[model samples]
Target: DAGITQSPRHKVTETGTPVTLRCHQTENHRYMYWYRQDPGHGLRLIHYSYGVKDTDKGEVSDGYSVSRSKTEDFLLTLESATSSQTSVYFCAITWDRGTGELFFGEGSRLTVL
Candidate 1:
């Protein structure tokens, strides 16, 4: 509640266009993640960074990519947006690794037509 923000909260794009969503956090947490929430699949991770410059692909990373150049910012880019990629994106940060509980940003809604 104190340290999270997402950009482009709502967007509509054409298929094959490039799009990028930004997540900003002031918590200075070590773990940050990008996830997509769909009707049936629920929340699935697209990518995550444990620390600055340390990133890894997640379960749904096929159509997405991410980068973390600084401690406070993480970016998710859809190189080529597709209709199937339409969904709500969420960013989360964790202060402790053991609990696995994350504080989430409101969300970024993207619709690909």
Candidate 2:
């Protein structure tokens, strides 16, 4: 079975509205990350947390934020939605500091109009 799951699975929102997406993990891992996958660009990290309340921005951090108040839950927020944010968002977890491979969730598809 997979280790991660993302909520909403799909969503549609108008421009300038705030949105939040949730990610849950049962793998008991130490690292959780939020990323967006777009055509041609592959996967780009939005944010990541190594421990509760310990988070950091990623490559595409603008207009996005994240929180991890517990071991199994991580949340991503979009301050104000825009058409550029319309993409498939994925949550990933890594087992340990050794192997770098990531286990991904089903994904949340958000469309901003």
Report lDDT (Cα) of residue 86, candidate 2: 100
What is the lDDT for 55 in model 1?
99
Q: Residue 67 in model 2: shift from native, Å?
A: 0.5
Estimate every model's Cα lDDT from 0 to 1: 0.93, 0.92
lDDT per residue as tens, model 1, 1-113: 74889999999999999999999998788899999999989899999999899999999899888999999999999999999999999999988545888889999999999
Report model 1's TM-score to 2 decimal places.
0.95
lDDT of 2 by residue, 2-112 (tens): 578899899999999999999998867789999999999999999999988999999999999998988899999999999999999999888776587888899999999
Clashes of 1: 0
Error of 2 at 46 (Å): 0.8
lDDT of 2: 0.92
